[model samples]
Target: MDRLSRFARRIFALGAGSSMALVFLVIFVNSVRRYTIGKSIAWGEELPIYLTIYGVMFGIAYAYMTDSHIRFAVFLDMLEEKIKRFVLIACDLLTAATGVTLIFAGHAFAMRRGSVASSGLKSTGDWLAQITGIPWLEWVGKVGTWQYAIVLGGAMLAIAAILRLSERLSAPSKAKEPVAPLAAPAGKAST
Candidate 1:
């Protein structure tokens, strides 16, 4: 389990970091070209948008894996220990369910829209064709190619949620803080 978690952490971190780097690189290059030569790559706009989506998805999974995702700690703190445990477990289950839903929904959406191609990417294909013998552009010009990031993010989220659930189940409960005593039953003889 530890090894699996470590692997997932690495993958999520690398994916998010790489996506951000690529987006930055592409935008920088495009800006330089536009300013210096008064021309920018046709697909520059579209590529960065897709890469940003990928980066956000990976970053979300990475945040959840690191236990940094949002939570209502104030509400949770108000509950009894056992109820808190139950609520935590339930929350984990809910997160896992959401992830699974994303997987199926994303897959269906991608398949339904897979045939449509982006005009920018289609034009960019010509640029790539000059270098590669294979028709790689045709494969990736479709929106569905990048939409798979949704599915990938869903899978990572599910894995992280389940791992957290397991850890929660195995860990010992924390000691609750002592509650203050009542006001001596409204001053009963002061003793």
Candidate 2:
């Protein structure tokens, strides 16, 4: 489990780094192009947008492992113990449900749109026509694109991770702060 989690973290980190680098590089390239050529690459903005979207999609797992995502703690904290547990469980369930919905809905959406080939926001998908001379790699683009697959896989992974977290949350966590006493009744011992 630890190994798997570590691998997931590494994958997420790599995606994030690649996304940021591409975004910055794209901006830099665009500025340079616009300065020198009096215009920018039409594809520059699109590439960065894709990278940003990819990063967000891939960052979910990392967010979970790092606990970096925001949580609304005030209401949760104010709840009594049993209610807190129930609320946590419900939150987990809702997260998992959302993940599952994304998986199915995204897959359906992708299927409907996957047939449309990208012209790269600039050219007429001509890049692939000339690059296939080697023959073996000819059908690469014709093959199903991995981006959609990533969406489906990511949604499943996200849901699975949520369920795993749900199970973990069900068990009492030992790393919690030392158990504190409830307020003492008037006659109770102080200790």
lDDT of 2 by residue, 98-176 (tens): 7777777767776776555544442423444566555433223321343464565457446546745755575774344
Candidate 1 runs further than 4 Å off: 125-137, 177-191
Error of 2 at 34 (Å): 1.6
Alpha carbon RMSD to native, model 2: 5.7
lDDT (Cα atoms) of all candidates against the true structure: 0.85, 0.63
Off by over 4 Å in 2: 80-86, 117-119, 122-125, 133-160, 163-191
Query: Per-residue lDDT for 58 in model 2?
Result: 66
Q: Clashes in each model (backbone N, CA, C under 3 Å)? A: 0, 0
Cα-based TM-score, every candidate: 0.84, 0.68
Candidate 1 lDDT score at position 132 = 82
